[model samples]
Structures are given as C-alpha cells and as structure tokens.
Target: MQIDVDPQEDPQNAPDVNYVVENPTLDLEQYAASYSGLMRIERLQFIADHCPPLRVEALKMALSFVQRTFNVDVYEEIHRKLSEATRDLQSAPDAIPESGVEPPPLDTAWVEATRKKALLKLEKLDTDLKNYKGNSIKESIRRGHDDLGDHYLDCGDLSNALKCYSRARDYCTSAKHVINMCLNVIKVSVYLQNWSHVLSYVSKAESTPEIAERGERDSQTQAILTKLKCAAGLAELAARKYKQAAKCFLLASFDHCDFPELLSPSNVAVYGGLCALATFDRQELQRNVISSSSFKLFLELEPQVRDIIFKFYESKYASCLKMLDEMKDNLLLDMYLAPHVRTLYTQIRNRALIQYFSPYVSADMRRMATAFNTTVAALEDELTQLILEGLINARIDSHSKILYARDVDQRSTTFEKSLLMGKEFQRRAKAMILRAAVLRNQIHVKVRGGGTGAGAAQLGTHTWAHGLVSIAVPSPGREPGGADAGQQPVPDEHQHVRVPAGPSRRICTPYPQLPALLEEPLGSRPRPPAWTPV
Candidate 1:
C-alpha cells in the first residue's frame, strides 16, 4: 500500500517467501508458479529444511493434492520412498539468493522452534478444517488420521488406534473410505480379543453394500468377508452358540483365490462341521449344513471335516465321536480354532447321545453302554444330563434301570388351548356388553299407555283328549286372608295365579269354570265386601 523497496533493487527473497500469508498482495500467478512442477518439489525440500512449521502445514496442504494428482497407492509409494530423500536436504546449505541477497544460514535453534510451531500449525489446521465447511478437506483429514491409526495399529496400541479409526470413520464423506476405516476397526478389535466388538464390526462390514454384495464377486473383498465371517463364527462357538456359529460358517465364501490370514480351509471345516453336527436337526443337517454349497466348498478345503459331519448325520454316532478323538492332535493345534476344541467335543458328545436315543422308547442303560462303548453308569449319567437340559423328554426309572419317554397328552394340551380360547371369548363378550349398554343409552324408546290394564294372554291351540283342564288367572297383588285392604275370594275351587310378565294385569281369557261358576249371587249374603262391582 505504501512505497516499498523496488523489486529490481530489493532481493528476490526466495521467490516471495516473505509475502504476508494472511493478506498477501503478491500476484497469485507468480506465487502459484513457485508451488508448481519442479519448483514445487524444490520449494517443499527448501521448506522442510528451513521452515519446519510451514513444512507440516505444507504437508497437510500439499500431500492431499499429490494424492489426488497421482492416487492413494502412488501417494503411499511416494511417501514411503521420497520422504527421507526430502528430509536429507534439511542439512544442506540454503540455496544462493535469487537476487544475490544471501539469506541467513539455516539456524538449528530457529528450526527447533519452527518444529514445535509445526504442531501448533497442525492444531490450527485441525480447527480450520472444523470451521471450513467443505467435504474435500474433511476427507483429507480423515485420511490423515487413518494413517496415524495404521501407525498405532502397527505399534499394537489398539486403544489409541481405535480412537483414531473411529474419528476417521465419523469424518468420512465417502462410502469407500468409511468401509476401509470399518475394516481397520475390525482388525484391531480382533487382535484385542474383543470378541463382542468383533461380531458387531463384522455385522457392520457385512451389511455395507461395497463389502457384502461384492464379497463373492471381488476376490479380496470376498477373502476379507470370509475371514470376518469365520471370526464371528469362532466367537459364537466360544460363547457356546453352536447354532449361530454354524450359520456364520455356512455363509462364508472360502473358495476365492485369496485366503484368510488366520483361518485355513481345515479350520473352516472343523468349526463349521462340528457346530452343524451339534445344532442341526436331522433334516437341517442334510439339507443346509452337510449338503449346502458353502459347506461343500468347505469340504473341499478339508474333506475330513465333511466326513465327520456326514457320519453324525447318518446316525454313525460312535464313529463321529471316535473320529473327533483321533483328530484332536491336529485340530487342537490351530491357533484360531484351538480355543473352541473342548466345547466342540462336548457338542459332538451331546449329538451322539441324541442320535443314540432316537429310536429308543425305553432302552436299558446296559444296551446304551454297549452302543456308546461306555459303562452303564456313564450312559445313565449322560441321559440324566440330557433330560435335565430339556433336550430329551424322558424320565429315568432308577429302580428298573430303564429310561422312559414321557407320553405327551394331546387331550390335555387341547383342553388347555380350549380353556384359553374361552377365557378370551369371555373377556371380549363383556366388552361387547358394555358397548351395547352404551349404545342402548344413546337411543330412546316410546311406550303406549294402558287404559283398563296391561294384559297378557296365553293362547292355547292344542287340546289333549280326556285331559284335565288347568287355568291361570291374574291374582290380586295383596295376599288374600292376610292383613291388607283387599277383598277375599268366595269359597270355591278356583285359585289365584300370578304371571310375572303381566303383573297387576288381567288375563282376558275366560275362566275354565265359566259355565258352572257364579252359581250364587254375589250381592246376597256376602254383599261382595260392600264395594264389589256387581
């Protein structure tokens, strides 16, 4: 803004390296040239040697541009190869001044100060990236953190690595990078033996579109998914979730050219086949586990795995257990698999018991011992355990030395079901009654008034031959011969009757004794209580 030294007279000053970074007025075209082509590399070397603070900032700014200019893989290669070459220039003397104004020597104390200042600059970069509202810079920072996470992972510091990877994933703007970060997290989680977290990470990785769908089509991705699935299966097996373990192993793709680092084909077979043998029912074992395509692929990896499973499915119970016992040496040696050996064998034993008892209603414990190649007492103990687990619906006759399956009462079950239905119906009926009462109150009913009286008459259309006649007539509300303001009936065979529907109303039908009744005049001796209507 003011009169400054002329460009021709003043030193070139390392090609405008002294320009104000905050509000520079230098021609952007000239400054841009210094960061371009061969000049860019030279300037980077110069800055790294001379300005440590600016070097970190420049690495933060320029590395991503290089990564974009080439690619991630190439950037990684260049970073690995050329980083030290550039650092060597830190000790080299500063280049001759562009305008013959020799710059000060590279000061160790000044560089020491700049190196510390670089961290502050990077911290400022962190804050700037937060406030900068752009996806590109955010993704750059994510990738930066990803590299740091990878370093921590290599150092076996999973706690800090997980922290970095988690932040990297959250800052990701693209699905590709997000999936990469997820896989990183899963890797650390597995190494840490955080089995529960491994399952969750595997689930997330499997559901990701880039991973799950392409798992089979892409060899690398498929291998990774296979490993993940295998890890999850092992976790399940460790937890004694044999059925879930079988499903996970059965879903894995093991035929790809790429193989997992931890799980071998044999490992897959043993874990998958044993889990299947333990949890699968007869039909499921044949259709989904032993004969399924995935299991078949696993079989090719290790035929013995399938053989053991097929033996169990065919009811060769003793053979299956014997095979597992013989192969214990090799199987128990696997690092990924050795942990689950006991539980797997226990499951095999339980399956053997289940298959052995399939056809028996009341098998003697001695015969069971013969079939299983064990003592009668051992067989009895196994049966008791099975019964207690609710796996077998039977009771042991300790005295008779026989095991009897409890006969299920279908009638009792049906009766209980019917009772439940009736209770539900009763509750619904009461609700309907209340609803009906509410509706009834909402409508008005009109009734006609009675003049003489409200009368109810019964019409008789049938007459039996030689049948004695019985007639019903309305009675006075007040009891006759009792203390009341009512008249008593004359002494005759006629008796009073009451009809609930027609209280205080006349019947209107003639009396059955009409012709023979009224033989004496009512007004003579009795005078009809002096108020009777004649």
Candidate 2:
C-alpha cells in the first residue's frame, strides 16, 4: 500500500536523500551509545555559556546526571562548571539586571526536597560502591556510616548513634571534626544518663584544654562546678549517705553563692533535702543553731542581704514561731525555769523595773519591757486563779493553812521588813515602765520634735505610781548572821503587831541608801540607801 506522508508532519519518517557524502560519515552506533555523554557535554556547554546566570536547579540536575551515568572525566568537568556557576551567582553584581535569564526561585521547601532526593541517590550509589576496592570509595563508605550514625543519634537512638559516632571519630581525617564528634558523643552519653561515660567524657573534655578554655571563668567554670557538685550530691542522696549528701549540698550552696542564677528549683530541692537529712544529727542541729545565730548577727552588717533573708524566712515565720514556742516550753523551761523559777521571776521583775527608768536604753529594750509586762500580767492572773481555787478546796489541811500563811506573809513582809528589797523590785518594775515611756517619748519626738508635752506628763504619772509602791514596802530583816532563814514564821494580818524594840529600831533607821529607782545600774552592785523609798 502506497501511503502518502507529509514530510513536515513527521520529519523522522522522511527518507534520507543522499545529496553528497561528507569526508567521513559518522557511525550511528558510536553516536547512539555516546548520546548520554554527548547530551551531558552539550548541557554543560549550555550552562558554561550562560555561566553567571545558570539556574541552580538546572545546574544541579545536569551535574547529578553527569555524576551518576558519566565517567570521572565528565563528572569532574561538570563539577568544575557547577562550582564556577555557583561562584558566579554568589559574586554577581547586585546592580546587574537578572531579567534576561531568570534564576529559579529558591524556595527552601523545594531545595530541601531536592536535597533529600540527592541524598537518597548518594546513598544508593554508596551501597553500590561498597564492594569496590578503592581507597576513595572506602573513605566515602566510612563517611556514609558516620553520617548515618549521627542521624540515628539526632533521632534519639543512642546506641546506634554512639556506634556511628565512634566510627566517625575513628575515620575522621581532620582533628577539629574528630574533636567535635567526640564532644557530641559525650553529650549524648550525658543525655542517656550514663554517669560513667559522662565522667569519662568530662575528663576527656577537660584534658583537651580547648573546651576547658572556651568559657568564662565565672560563667563556665562555676557553672560546670555547680553541675558537678549537684550531680555528686544527687548521687550521695541516692546512695542514702545522708552526711555525704549534706556536705555535697553545702558545697553546692557555696558554689551557688558565686553564681546566684544557679540557685534554681533543683538547687533548692537539694538544699532542703540535705537540711532535712542533717537535722537528724544532734551535732548538726547545734551547728545549725550556731550558724543561724551567727548569720542573724551577720545580717546586721549586711542589711540588704538580711532583708532578703528576712523576707524569705518570713514566709515560714508562722511555722518558725510555733517551733519557737515548742522549744521554749520544752528546752528553755527545763534549762532556765525548772530549777530557778522563783529566782527567774524575781530577776525578770527587777530588770523590768530598772529598765523602765533608763531613758538611755534603746527602743528594743522598751519592746522587751512590753513583752516582760505581758508575761508578768499573765503570770499574776494565773497565780490569782490558783490562790482563789486553793481557798475553795474542801480538803484543806494544816499544811494548806501554813501555805496560805506563807503566801500572806510573803506579801506582808514586802511592806514590813524587806522595804529595801521591795523597793528594788519596785524600782526594776518602774524601770520597765519607764523604758516604755522612753520609747513613747522618742516616738513623740520623731513626730513633733519639741511640740508634744503629753508623753512627758504620762511618763511622770507612771514614775510617781512606781515611787509610791516602793515606799509602801518594808525592808527585809537579816537573820541573826544575815544568813537566809529557812521556813521563817509566816506573818498574816494578825501578825502586824508591834515589832520587838531592837528590830523596830533597826527598821526605823532608814535602810542603807537604795539605788535610784529611775537610774539602777546595769551591774549587780547593791545600791546605796540614799535613794531608798521614805
């Protein structure tokens, strides 16, 4: 069948007309077999021609093909051209018009996609080259293994990651790269909580000097020291070695003092934990008390730090107050009150009286006076209740009568025999009152300077009351040799009869000059009787 074909419609189907033979006809097989190579050369020539304006995507594709299918010569040529093109693109004049040969828009997504594809292709090529007996190929395989190991590590597969990293370290040609790989391996080990490995790596990183010398003295060294200390503390705590843990915590505290920023929640936990552990030891408690007292005194020197600590402790102040109350009841009572309750009460009353008159004492003394007054008031109410209850008791005995007589006698003797002692007690009590007055006066002075007269008048009235009480009390009689008489006769209302002549003479002669009620010395020396109540 004769088919009419249009030459323009199918150019390849047209019969070749032998016009004139060239000097040598090109062989079709040689050309067909070399088509890929020829096409690569042509593509490269086109890129080279366009040079500076070569599209990155097009160049990448062309180079990739050249690398995959072509021989080393072709691949190298393509690589050289690609490098030249990249350089030209990078160095191109900013003012040059890019309108003629539009470069592909560098969308990061597209670039990444292409990179992934290239990597996959490279991986396949690497697998293919694994059996090849060449130094370069072996080196490439080594790098591929290293890269795979790193990938596993980044994905959190520590075991495989470590293996890959170790391989990388072994095969790494550059010292810097090897060092980096080693550090990275150590970091992974730390993350994995491999303490031994961490220690080893830290030691290695330290010995290297480069890593050690890399950070600031205060920042780097202090930070690492803090971590090490914290880690050590945690270890000790885990081991249930409480004393060691406490020591570690103390060291950590010192370290944290150097870097306050490191006083994080974890550090606080460590501190609290250690403190709890240490509190079990009696020696530790004593040490803590001494330290705390010293710290409080030190706060006086550093008011700012003191204020911070105060605020910090203030949050726990209620609890601390409760603890203080318990300790006072338990320890302080046993130590100070149990053996010397009567003496303590007398001393407290005396001190309060003396401080009341001392205007020279500070406001703190006035506060103490107020506290003492409250204590005395409470004690007096308690004693009054006890006495009233005792008087109502149905099972009263002669001993009870004697007890009642002694109580009555104690009160009466204050006005009869021991006028000086009563006056001294009254003076101390007045001193306490006067201390309060002084504090009020200071406050008034602060508020209105010389303007206020009310505080002074109030103070005068308080002092007068104190003096009246002092004069109403009697001087205490000395025993035959001035020794204290045990179980002396109890004097009741009926015992207010006339004193014997010699004793009355002694009582009527004004007692040795008593200390000024308003100006009792801080010393224990007996005051002269000149200031004694009339």
Candidate 3:
C-alpha cells in the first residue's frame, strides 16, 4: 500500500518545491532591470528555485545585487545556492567549460563589515527613537521608527522591519503620518508574502482621510492611489480571486504606476489582461479592458497581452487560445502569476467554448472542434462538463455529435410576462385614477381637533343639495344654531368622506373669505354665515 501525503502549507511562507519549470522564455536581464531592491533579489531567487536552465544565472545576479545592500545573510544564502547550481551544471554530461560559470568567492571581510555597520546603525536608531519618545515629539518618533524599519528591511529582516513599521503607528500625528506608516508596513508585508496583511494595510491607507477625500487633480494623491491599487491586485491574485484582482490592476493609473519595488507597467498589463480574459464576459471585456483609455496605456507596454485580449473579444477563439499558449512559458516565470496560470488558462478556454455556442441554438460538434482547435472527443467531453455544470442549457447527442439547446416554450413565457405586465398596469391605472379624483375634488384633510364653537358643531358635516356635497367646518367662538347642531362630534381618527353616486359636482368646502351657508336636512336653508376678511 502506498500512502500519499499532501504537503503542509505554511500560512507565513509558501514554498512550491515540487513545482518545476523546464522551459522559460524570460529575458532575465531585462526582467531584473525592471525592479530594484529586495524585489529584484527575490524575483531572481524565485526563478532560480523553479527553472533549472536559469538557476545559475539567476543566483549569480541575485548574489551580485545582494552585495549592494546590507543584507549579508541573503548574500551568503544566494552564494551557497550559486555554488550548488554551478556544480550541477559542471556535472552535466553536455556541460561546456566556462570561466564565469563558477560561483564568486565569499566576501567574508565585507560581510563582517556590513554586519557591524548594520548593528551600529540599529543601535543609533534605537537611541534616537528613545530620545524622541523622551522628548515627546511625535513626528520625530515616527521618523525614527521608520528609519529603523528601513534599516531592517535593507538587512533582509522582514519580520523586524514589519514590526518597526507597525510600531510607528503609535507615533503617527496626522493622516499623512498614518498613510506613510501603512505604506511601509504594506511594502514589507508584500515582501514577506503576507497577503492578508498587505490587503489590510492597503485598506487602512486608502481609508485615511487624506487619501479618501483627495481630489483626482492632485498628482501626488493619484500616484499614491495607484500604488495602493497595485498592491491590492497582487494580494487578490495570490488569493485566487481573478475577477477582483483584475479590477484592482485595471484601476491603476498608468502615469502613476511607479511601484518598481513590486511590479512594472508590463506586469500590470499582463496580470490584468489575463485575469480579465478568464473572468470577464464579452461586454465587460470590451467595455473595461478594450475601451478603457487609462488601461490602454498599460496594455501598450505588452502588445502581446493586449492583442490576446482583442482577439478574444473579436470572437477569434483559435487565434486567441494559440496566442495564450505561446505566452504560457513566459507567464509561468512570473512568481505572482505562476501558481494560477493553469487555472486561468482553463477558465479562458471554457469561457471561449461557452461564448462560441452562445448565439447558436444548435452547433455541429465537428465544426466546433475545429474552431476550438481540439479533437471531436475532447470537444464532446468539454461540452459534457459544461452541460452538467449548468453553464450551457443544452443537450448533447453522442451518436450525432450535435449540441442542441434545450427547447423553451417562449409563447407561454411571453404570455405569462404580458399578463403580469397587464396586471401591474391595471393597478397603476387604478391608483392614478384615485389620485386624479382626489386632486380634482381638491381634498384637504388635517388631523387637528375640532375646537369648541359653531365650528366644532359643524365640523365633518356633509350636506347634499342638487347632487353637490359641501363639507362644513365649525367656526371658532360661534354658537351652534344650525339644523345639524345636535349632531355628535366625529371621532378623533380619520373620517371617511363619501362621494355621492350621482353625477359629479364641484366640491365646495368652507373658506375664510367666502360666506358659507348652513342648511337643515328637512329642505330648509339657514342664513349665510358672515364672511371674515383676512
């Protein structure tokens, strides 16, 4: 019996030891040139770990670069890897003699010197921070902490760097201080591959009052926002949320994309383009990717990715998929994109298949296979999966090799929809008619109490004469002597006033300026009340 154990994944560090890259078309020199600091060193190390052909060269570049910083440990580590890689190359049967292939001798003196300088600098920063705290100067304390974090980061101590950066939070005096602190923490977190921390700080920085309320015309704010978006994109990509990652990358302003420590303009194009291709529908791809003015600038940095997106949108599945495959090797070399390449490609292919059959009620599997650049059997299997997943409302005939859309009773559906619409229209029409009647009658109702007087006695009195109805309101401070004086007061709640069934007449209510008459129910008319001028 064989037992297979899944590799334990560490939340802090994810090592893809089992994954290897045999062929990569990356121009190592040009790619390294696009980044700086720890970003350049880390990317080169990642390439060395994954691709054998480029291992020695990548390690050599990393070694050369690491010496420029105070990171003595990483320098020695890269040197060790370089030694192993060089030996492996030399032992190869097809190995050719090369002079520079051998690893460089370790610089013990420089390492010792750098460590001493680093320690001395750390002591000075700590002393300065303590002095700032003693003096109670917030800005000085904040800068002191940031300086320490920067030194720690330079020494390749990401944990200490993150801690120092986070510690600066307590000394932050304003929105700017908080944003700067967050950016520092976010940068170190990205280097540490702490994606959740990166996202959390990105949100914090963005929510800062200065960043959130910043005007678009502010160039500095736009640049900062671009950095935030790019960092957020990397985190979302690592989390396997292709759509959200695409949105984040797409939102980055080309003119403001200057985060060389993490990504380049070309990276933005590739990451956003591929993720959008895999996740965006035809309309979204066209509207957000192809038609975007800002993203167009990014796409110009990588014409191949831009072309793939255009071809996909134009419904040229064969050309698009072929282009995607051609670039697969280069994409696999990207540290952030490598793990998701296969998944993204599969999604893009499936989306293409779905789009190809969208407008057709039935399609011939043979032609579909040719269009998709796949065999009939493969196409049938794909269609089967899509059918089972409910992505396509269709049925497959195995013998005929035909995919047919399921029949739907459009007539019944249309009839049902029309009936619902008609009912809604009837309801609206009734409401409108009621409103019109109320408006035409000029109804004015209020919940005020009927105060004591002739007004109180006459309140809510409805009198009908010649099919006309008039509402009489009691006049204040007047005795009730009308024929309906004995009528009881209406309840405090709303009173339902009814309209006569006969032909409509102009609705008359008591007005202050007009002389209103009081009447009895026995066909008797009382004297008109005196009019009071306002």
Candidate 4:
C-alpha cells in the first residue's frame, strides 16, 4: 500500500515552519545560555522559533552537553519546549493527502519515522539517568521512574505502574519524597484491595520519626489508616475472634470520627456487627464489666457508639425480659443488671420500654397486670407499717399530755395544746403517705393492664433509679471537718467535722433570733408558768 504525503496536512511543513526554526547553532554554549534565559522567562514560543529543524538525536546530545558543562537551566528549557511541541502535535489532525495531491509514500513514512525517532531520543535521555551514580543522579532517576509510572498509570497498567513507583520510592531520601512514595504505594494497594499490604505500608509511614514529628498528619494518610484498621477488625470478626474484633472495630469507629467522611453506611454496618458479636460473647462482657476504668475509657472514646450498642441490646430486650420473668429468683437480673444497674435502668426506661413496651403489652397484657399487682401489694404493706408507727407515736404524746395536765395546776395547758397540734400533723402525714401509696398502685395497675395507660411509667422508674443512685452513693471523697476517720459517712454528708485535741469544753453560743410569727393567734389565753428549776 502506497501512502500519500500532503504538504498542507503536515504540521512541520506549514508556512509557520520557517517561523519556528530560524536560528542556527554558531556558538553552541552562548546559544544554549540564551535559550535557557528565554525559557526561564517562560518565553517558550521564542525558543521554539529559534531552534533548528527536528534534529532529534542532536537535540538530545546538546541537552546532555548543556546539562554536564553548563547548568540544568538549558536541559529543563529543552524539555519544556519538547513537551509543549509534543502536545501541540497531538492536538493537530493526522496528516492526510489533499484531493489530487498524490504525494509519495516515502514522504509519509518519513514523517511518522521522524516523530518516533524524537520520542525514542527523549526515552533514551530518561533512561540514561540509571547509569549515573550518587544521590543527585538517583533523584533524576527517581523523577524518570515517576514519569514512567504516571504514564503506565494513565494507561491503566496498574501493576507496572506500581513496580515503577516502588523502584522510585527505594531511592527516596527526603522526608517529603518518602511520604509521597508511601502514599502512592497506599493508593495502589487500596485499589487492589490488598488490605495486608495497605496496613504494612501505613505502619511504615507512621513509624517514621519525621512523619511522627509533623504537627499534623495529612488527612488522606489518616483516612487510609482508619480504613485499614476497620478492615483488619472485619477480618478478625470473620475469623471468629470476636473480642479482638470488637476492640479493633471500636478503635476504628473512634478514629473514623476524626474524619467525618469515613462514617458511611458501610462503616456503620461494620461497627454494628462488631457490637452484635460482643453481645453474644458472655466471656467478653464479663471481662469488661468489672473494670469500670475500661468502661469509662470506652465511653470517652465512642460516645456515639453506645447508642448503636444499646439499640442492639434493645433488639434483644425481649429475651432479657423473658429471662427476668421466668427466673423468680432474680438471678438473671443479678448477672446482667447489678453490675450495670444504673445504665440498665436508664436503657430499660428510655430505650427498651419506649421501643418494645407497646408490642409486649399487645402480646400479653395479663402478664404485665400480674407483675404490677405483686409490686403494688409489696408497696401497700410498707406504707401500712409506716402509718401505724406514726399513729402510735401520736397516741403516746397525747397520753403524756393528759397525765401532765391532770397533775399540774393550769401549768400544763401549753403541753396539752402542743400534743393536740402533733396529733393533727400526724393525721395529715398519714393521709399523704396513704394517698401516695394508692396513687403508685393505681399507676402500676394501669401500666400493666393496658387500660388507662401510665405513659412512660418505665421511664419514670428509670429516672427514679437514677435519682436513687445519685442520692444514695456518697461522693468519692470526704470533706474536711465532718466525720471521724473510722466512721462511714452518710450519703448526703457534704462536710466533715473535726474535733480539736484540747480538753473537752462546751462552747456556749446563742441561736439567731427568729422572725416574728405572723400566723399565731392574737388573743389566745396564756398558760400558768410551770415550776422553775433552781
């Protein structure tokens, strides 16, 4: 097949060809210097215009001589020009013969041959850096490898691209260059889903002292590390190392929070799965439960994770409730609830009941009614005892007043009046206690029977438990001047009382004057004075 050459289609043969190459090399050194200066000024068009016709081999040789004898200035200039020229040619249309032009085949072959020759010359220059010695030469070699790797990467040859990058990274000496190489390796490993390799490279990158000393690690690096950690956790989960997996997943979830981008649905699902695994493993829970310190640390690290975790438990609340109901001895509650009583109560009241109570009641209201009846009966008995004690105290006071009033002449009238007031107060107190007990029982019955429902009764119970813990548990340490070292302090005690080392001497102090009583009767008859002590 004969290929026709078209003069109009040939970029090199265009009218601008003369404008592109008008300068010849008379003083090679001076010309190279002048050309480098033009390039430094970013006047690429001038250099292109002055350079000779496409003498590919000669141009490369001149560039090498300029690099060796003069400076990199000329070499960089030539590379810049050549790159621009190549881009321009690529943008131009392929050479085609015009109608009736009938160009010769050799001419067309010569054009393709010339372009290939130029590319080969540049390729050789790129490769020759490998033969040079020293770190400076190695840097050039690294650049060449990087350029080649980019070419391969752009061409979709990931394996070859990785190989080139790996070679370049081996020669990297600067911290910046090393970090770049590590990042490149990480990118490829991630693309390939080589999780183990990704972790290894990340570990190496992070272990570098220079990288460690950096005030802030790069976000991309942190994100990659977070993802690898999560993947490692998933692998452990797959291997049935549930405890280890939970630890890893928890760490990953916490770390991922640093970069909000990692909190995708996939990661959430992974976190949820780890939590589910932990729930199934009783040994893991037992090991973690006693160490309040560890639980605190977990809370600090993953505040959001607890909600998902509790939700997981909420799904299993029915099972826990069933266990509680079936075991009359409260053994199951002791096992699961006592260690985490405060948290369990809150979860039951806030989350578990809110989500499951309706379904539970719908399934069987009779069971709830029975439970409520038992609780109400116990509360009623306690209230009855309290009322009876109050009545007995009031009766004793009344009897004492009557005996004193009969023996003393009009002097015991104040005592009689005080006793009567005490009886009234006791009566009111008993009624209030009875009313509270009755109301509690009614609420319990309503909650259990699914009649007029006690909305959020479970929540109220949880709040009550929280309040009990808050009120009953003593603050961590004792205050000064309040309690003796050997004595246990009361829960509400805020200060300690200190006794001095001196002999026992009572200190007499006057009480503050009380305000005038506005509610007292104005015309009440006065009682005679009782016998005064001498």
Off by over 4 Å in 1: 1-136, 207-227, 257-259, 398-400, 411-415, 418-534
Which regions of candidate 2 deviate over 4 angstroms?
1-150, 164-186, 203-218, 223-534
Pairwise TM-score winner, candidates 3 and 4: 3
TM-score between model 4 and native = 0.28
Ranked candidates, highest TM-score first:
3, 1, 4, 2
Q: Could you tell me the TM-score of candidate 3?
A: 0.76
- What's the TM-score of each model vs. the native? 0.52, 0.24, 0.76, 0.28
Query: Per-residue lDDT tens digits of candidate 3, residues 240-344?
Result: 899999999999999999999999999999999999999999889989999999999999989999899988888999999999989887887888998888889
RMSD of model 2, in Å?
38.1
Best by lDDT: 3
Candidate rank order under lDDT: 3, 1, 4, 2
Lowest lDDT block of 10, candidate 3: 514-523
Model 2 Cα lDDT, one tens digit per residue, 326-423 = 32222111111122222223332333333232332222322332434444345344334444655222121222221112224557766786888888
**lDDT for 11 (candidate 4):** 53
**Candidate 2 vs 3: which has more lDDT:** 3
* lDDT for each residue of candidate 4 in 384-451, tens digit (9 for 90 to 100): 34336542111112222210111334558888988999999987765555344323322121122233
After superposing all C-alphas onto the true structure, candidate 1 shows an RMSD in angstroms of 26.2
User: What lDDT score belongs to each candidate, Candidate 1 first?
Assistant: 0.57, 0.39, 0.82, 0.40
Superposed on all Cα atoms, the candidates' RMSDs to the truth, in angstroms, are 26.2, 38.1, 10.7, 34.1
The better candidate by TM-score, 2 or 4, is: 4
